[model samples]
Target: MSDNQNLLAGQRRALILDEVRRRGGVRVSELTRMLRVSDMTVRRDLDALARQGMLEKVHGGAVPVPEGRTHEPGFEAKSALETSAKYAIARAAAGFAAPGGAVALSGGTTTYAVAQQLVEVAELTVVTNSVRVADVFHTAPRPAEGGPARPATVVLTGGVRTPSDALVGPVADAAIAALHFDVLFLGVHGLSEGAGLSTPNLAEAETNRHFIRSARRVVLVADHTKWGVTGLSSFAALEQVDVLVTDSGLEPEARRVLAERVPELIIADAEEE
Candidate 1:
């Protein structure tokens, strides 16, 4: 109401924006402490920013506006963007697989990396649409301590191919409907608190949705850059995922929101490589 009060509110909002920009996300409690503002004040500021299209407001915080989420990159291009981060996430995600159980993998560079790690798995039933991903298991042999190792069974979904090498269409969707998996690993173009799990291709989104339904437990593998981007179509929500394996490049604020919203959060540190 007063001149100084207005100035303080303006300054606090500016700081809030800066913090979210730097960390990709921010929590209300942390913002209150950092900005020395009341709970109501923080919410009001976040709401204002959200209305301005500057950020997306989540359960307890805000994430910076995801840029280029609607843009789909080719497989080769994406694989080169975050090589180290993808490897770390892949390894972490592969640990979730049950040795003899079935697993469904979506198309993406990160998921492909996960599949590569899965080549070591002696026995696994893998269902996927990516040619490269399926090849990893079929071509690579798993060494066994005794006699011959049981080969991993890879079921390829038939459908139209995209720039990212994902198979999608009525065919792919139908294949997913007929089978159930122990776990599903989904890789998306971008993740936003509001949009949930999203991708640039509509057909891929449709196909990925069935993968979510086929598996009782779903895990999302993505790098930090995927946080703010909201793809053109959303396949799953943040709460729908059973586990998330991401790289340490994620901001602390984003990490906090994930820990609060999701059941489990695993940050794959690249230093282990």
Candidate 2:
């Protein structure tokens, strides 16, 4: 490559890494616009980073490498949706967890809420791939203040980080495969009868699959808004989910479908709580 070409390539790679760290991931279209480069140039840059293992390239974007734990969505953005519903779901989910049970909490807003509820529970072991979820347990107070002793153990999966600050990909999958959990609670970007549970990233989907396989039971936690929407990747089929926990706002037809498809469907009315 010529001097100018080499410089441009380096600049593009740097910008890609920066965007992944800032946003957790960056779509090719966004990178092309930000770098003022063609689609092909952006793809080339992503490929280079993938080769170096700086990031994991997916269908439309790239995920950050696991290193600094600071990468994740801002509190405001993540806390914007289904706040009440998430809490209710968290409450219901926590009820199913025994005092010393091992649980895998996947990354997502709803799962984050579940982690918060777990603060009051004693002797629970939580394995997660979310930086934000891990922080919840790490900062929880001791039982003297009427809280549980945080949690017995918190395991963070290592891998590429998504814009949502989720750790995913091969490293995360490997970690999940090595352990078995009594229950696994997952949060999805979308839920559909035809599409099942879905996420916006392929690497995350793979990581979720491993989580499902490693768990004795899989519980899906999603607000009503997730129903009917289709994301970029399909993680698990509805049949694979042992329980479906959703908000009361879900339509009657949706409830019927979930009841028929999954073994158990729990709807929590946030307004009632």
Candidate 1: which pairs clash?
Answer: 66-228
Determine which window of 10 residues in candidate 2 has minimal summed lDDT: 67-76
lDDT of 2 by residue, 1-273 (tens): 223344446555765676786588889998766766679988887887777656889889889766322233333344544567889988888777778889999988899998898877779999999998998998887667654455789999999878787899899999999999999989888889999988768898899999999999998899897898777788899999998889898999999999999999999999999
Please, what are the lDDT tens digits per residue for candidate 1 over residues 1-273?
233244455556666776887788989999877766579989998997777666789999999766574667677646545677899999999988877889989999999999988776657899998887988887885575785455458899999999889899999999999999999988989888888888889999999989998899999999998897888889888998899999999998899888888899999999987
Model 1 segments beyond 4 Å from truth? Answer: 1-69, 142-150
Q: Each model's TM-score?
A: 0.73, 0.71
Predicted structure with the largest TM-score when compared to the true one: 1
State the C-alpha lDDT per candidate: 0.84, 0.82
**Model 2 misses residue 70 by how many Å?**
23
